[model samples]
Target: MSDDVRNIDDALSRITAYWQPHRLTSINDYDVKVVKIHGEFVWHDHPDTDELFMVLNGELIIQLRDRDVVLGPNDVFVVPRGVEHRPKADEEVHALLFEPKGTVNTGSAGGEMTSPLRELP
Candidate 1:
């Protein structure tokens, strides 16, 4: 494989659109994706794997079944699999997501927010 790689900003620029995630790098069985989020997402749960969300810019609020967690820039949260949750943001937000390869963004609940596995910048 080629050793050359691009930086995060370069990747973000290519994926300026919202909700569409651009695959970055992967470690072992996990893949890293960068996505721009806005508004609210559907409630869902991943029964097979945990998801890591790292805020890169703006802010995000993840609403669980009972409680909610607000994340700002440089903040991070881990959503355990099988727990229903939804993400919301008043303004545009940017974040880095880490999950196992083939892990659907929408998890068990399917909707328009579901994303296909895509290549990174």
Candidate 2:
């Protein structure tokens, strides 16, 4: 990918799996990843990195340690690092995730949803 390219639509189509992220673009040490998510995700938190979730389609409910944030299309929220969270959607949801380059999706609690590394589809 070229540094000048920033077409999200083109990046979305290239993504091929659930929970898996396709590197879209990067700003300094952070990278944006386009992901397609459905159902429920495991509860976890990144001890040293904040996670930004931007909904592109459908809806999502982010369950936090204290409250839940409902997100619709174009809605965005950030889960601060070390704050436990779980993402759920009644139907298929497309979202753009932003975090530092080496941030893990499932944080320290590696399980089924954890990807070895972020890759471009």
Candidate 3:
């Protein structure tokens, strides 16, 4: 993407991998990412930074230690720092994540599913 206005939906459509996030852009200390995912993700938390999940398509359910927050297109939710949370989807869901630049996808729970930081095309 160029150093200009970006359309989130347009950026997401270029992704072909499930659960892999493409960095859309950076805002100060935060990075905006677009990911395509299906099924459940591991429970994790960023101890030092909050994470924002914004659904652009399909449905998503964020499973918190206490309760579940369901989301659909255009919905947004923020997971506070140090809060354990897991995200799941019954079908292919497209979403955008906002968090610090170095925040890992798996947070404290490292595994094979964790992907390296990516760049947007």
Candidate 4:
């Protein structure tokens, strides 16, 4: 991390791929990342850590085992560790994720949607 000022929207605009997270910075052992997502994501859970999701644009539905949590712009939600969850979006969504460093996009049920964190330039 540097003493640099970055525009979130401008940085988000450069992210061309969906469900792919671009690292913005790091604090302690966690990373702050931005991602563009559309369609439905794979159902999975981080066994070792809780995942935080903050919707930057559009709406998102976090599907949990018992119920679904709907999130709107500027909304924040944390899926507790070991909880099975799947994120679904009918349209495109811009969001930020805060999790431990090297947390894979796809957690335990890793499949095609898994992605290594992409660092911002």
Specify the highest-TM-score model's number.
4
Steric clash pairs (candidate 3):
none
Worst 10-residue lDDT window, candidate 3:
1-10
Candidate 4, overall lDDT? 0.92
Error of 4 at 113 (Å): 0.9
lDDT of 3 by residue, 94-116 (tens): 99999888889999888987998
Q: After superposition, how far is residue 92 of candidate 1 from its true place, in Å?
A: 1.0
lDDT of 2 at 24: 82
Assess every candidate by TM-score.
0.93, 0.91, 0.93, 0.96
Model 4 lDDT per residue over 15-90, tens place = 9999999998788999999999899999999999999999998999999989999999999999999999999899
Provide the global lDDT of candidate 2 against the true structure.
0.86
TM-score of 1: 0.93
Report the alpha-carbon TM-score of model 2 versus the true structure. 0.91
State which candidate has the highest lDDT.
4
**Each model's lDDT:** 0.87, 0.86, 0.90, 0.92
Q: In model 1, what is the error at residue 51, expressed in angstroms? A: 0.4
CA error at residue 7 for candidate 1, angstroms: 0.8
> What ranking of all candidate models by lDDT puts the best one first?
4, 3, 1, 2
The C-alpha RMSD of each candidate to the native structure, in angstroms, is: 1.5, 1.4, 1.4, 0.9
